[model samples]
Target: MHIHASLRFPRRLVDRRLLLSLSLAGFFVVHSTHAASFDCSKATTAIEHAICDNETLSQLDSTLNEKYQTAMANLSDEGASELRKNQRSWLKERDACNADAACLENLFNQRKSSLQATTQQAETQLDAIIASIPADPANAAYQLKQYRGPLASAWLVYLNRFEPTSGVTAEEAKQRHQVAVTALNKQNDFAASLLKDIENDPKTSKNVAVLTFLRMTIEQGRYDEVPPRPDVHCFVFSRQGDAAYRAFGALWGSSRDSQAPICPPQGNLFELPAWKQLNKILDPVMSAAYPNSGTIRYASYADWAILRLRATLSPTDFLKPIEGQSQESPEKRISEWDDKSWPKVQREQLLIAIDPARKATMEWLQTERKFTASDASKASTAIVNAWLNEQLDYLSENLSTGDQ
Candidate 1:
């Protein structure tokens, strides 16, 4: 699928300021005004030094200050004074992080998570900060590593707003979801403007996460296109919980007899690299150290949305064979080679069905996915190994989720 195709977006919910700020044909970009806790030019502590050195860090700092000031405004004089004192204390701890980008990032993480934006007042105060996406590059290169937490949280709230909640009528939930789909579609359309700009610029476009985020925005946008269901479905992307180790499904929280798995959309090598980049790892970094979940890696919206869309489409695809297609297991299919009585065409068909699937995977990786020769070879070898070992049962049972 060409994920880049443009779609119609609604204008109902978008802020007017954002509408006015967009400039496509103009020579000059209108930058959003934002400010930080302290002046950037003055010689400062390690954390301040890090913030001054990087535009993203500085942007985040500006946003953080904006959030803090808003937090203070809501409080009484005594509360505001106490928060001011707390801010100074926090600044001291933050300044202690001087020059360590990772340490400074941790501070932002802690600070942002600690602050809440519940009411309209907080949202209004913080609106400009969220709206202040720097032109062309929506996500700053490398700085996305620091942003994964906050952006993911924002995206989640957006989705969860549509999810069926306890006691909400199925009809009401569907109505809300229909509304959500429209809002999400518009959000992606707006983001696509910036994304398309990045894709045109060879220098910034190659940063895979930018592409990943863009694709994710587009995929999540399929809400409008998705067919509604009777029961509430919480799409499961990973093999976790009691059903952990199985393929995808709609893990029903209320147990309403949903048998099929929900498969999220899968990203190719181009987008996957950007995702891993944002998470600060070459591979999906498992959160072994975290006390609760076995693996702490947060699945990107693209990854999960693909799974959900896949699951939503052919829910029972894994359990049943297409009527005209061969249901023969890979082991049986391969064993037919030993049969002198086996028809030549049948043998070729079986070989064609399985071998091409594997080869296509490798070819796709090397060509379409733009994998490096070494990486393609390594990945292709793994597919060959799975075939050789007749582990194709797992693949067949799971609708040929490639190189899983």
Candidate 2:
């Protein structure tokens, strides 16, 4: 489907200054207007005292801090680390000019100019990289490695937000997440501005929204924070249709009868084209993953969504004829599926049903989901039971959901 043709986004006027101020608020680790970057009450060194004592120097320090943070935000991990190291080295040199306002001002100006230049260069490179991206919704996370700098690093955290950090206490994990949040917060202004621009551009808006929805779905499991607008629904349904549908029926969460597998909320995303796409990837999408409370399939969210959507749209596709049963009635198929006696032979039927797209799904599993050949070949049996339970549970719900 032509995503742009199907979706329309409402334009929003962004106040760049407000965004910048918000970014600044989030940028500083320590909130202080007097010293700007650090607290003056704890000022120890002569350099710190000198800056705190003089309003002009303090303002220069604050201005330089902004530029320094902006440069760090756009730089790669190695680049940001190097910048930090350089800043520390510069601090030592600046200390030598203790209480010398003229020297301090010169050094601050030069550092500010250098940071501005660095930020400009990094932004230029990042913008080119973003422009080159194809805006495709499938396998969005795979495109992440192509990014670099702190922005890239922040994305790394975002994409892998659910991954377990070995041997870390819960507190440690929380601390690490806070660190990641701090890093991403620095780019809030830039991200806000970019989103505003995307919302205003009709041609690229839906494509960008689809890409963003896919990425966020993989990252956060749901983009519920966004309003339930028509274009938003279009893009989300295009990528994670099944999950959206299941979510719409209120099938997820703690409800005991909620047979729908855990997925991102759909928010009125049911549409024919989106449902057809879900039908296309039904098996692997269904066989892909089973998310429980506080658990997710990670990058496989899209695949799972497709399967769930397909099941919702066409449950008959999941009902396979038993072996040696030459003529099966709809009653028999429903009875067997309901009895949970749906044979393992039905798995073979699924293979046949999905034969045409088996290769495509296999490649997606192996590449996008990093599934091994063996696992991908079987369309991932790790969650077959989850799929079965989902089928049984959701079928029992008596939902009248499908593309009508």
Question: 345 in model 2: Cα distance from truth in Å?
Answer: 76
Error of 2 at 128 (Å): 1.8
Error of 1 at 179 (Å): 15
Give the Å error, residue 210, model 1: 25
Which ranges in model 1 have alpha carbons more than 4 Å from their true place? Answer: 2-7, 10-63, 66-85, 88-404
Model 2 CA lDDT for position 166: 20
lDDT of 2 by residue, 324-397 (tens): 11232222333344213234454345435433344554454566556678766564222232233334333333
lDDT of each: 0.38, 0.44
**Count of backbone collisions in candidate 2:** 5
Query: How far off is residue 216 in model 1, in Å?
Result: 9.7
lDDT of 2: 0.44
Compose the digit string of candidate 1's lDDT tens values, residues 311-347.
2232233233222123344444444433332334544
What TM-score, over all chains together, does every model reach?
A: 0.24, 0.35
- Lowest-lDDT window of 10 residues in candidate 2? 1-10
